[model samples]
Target: MIAHGSLILVLLFTSPLMEAFSQPTKVVTLVMFKWEIKEEARLLERRMLYLHETLDVR
Candidate 1:
């Protein structure tokens, strides 16, 4: 429980900095960007559940 609590606290403290760094770049278009994804290897999902318009089209 303490580990989770401390993780939450750390996330809360650095959220703004993380958000600034989390902005999406190299947007996917035509479904081909999966080839050049830079962040991670999984379909690329946002964990915050925010309604962000990526403006990407396939």
Candidate 2:
């Protein structure tokens, strides 16, 4: 009975730590996704500027 109680206690303590560790990985992924979106927007802006400059040359 004592061992069962200790096991439950260990599980309760570890669950939050497990959740904390998992949360950062999701946050990192979201940050990386946002960075990628920003990079894509920058690339599109540059392309539009380049197109306008070329059109003006003609």
Give a tens-digit lDDT track for model 2, residues 1-58. Answer: 5698899999999999999999999999999999999999999999999999989854
Stretches of candidate 1 above 4 Å error? 18-58
TM-score of 2: 0.73
lDDT of each: 0.58, 0.95
On lDDT, the candidate that comes out on top is 2
In order of listing, the candidates' clash counts read: 0, 0
Put down candidate 1 lDDT per residue, 1-58, tens digits, no spaces. 4698899988897997677666543233524566557435433555322324444345
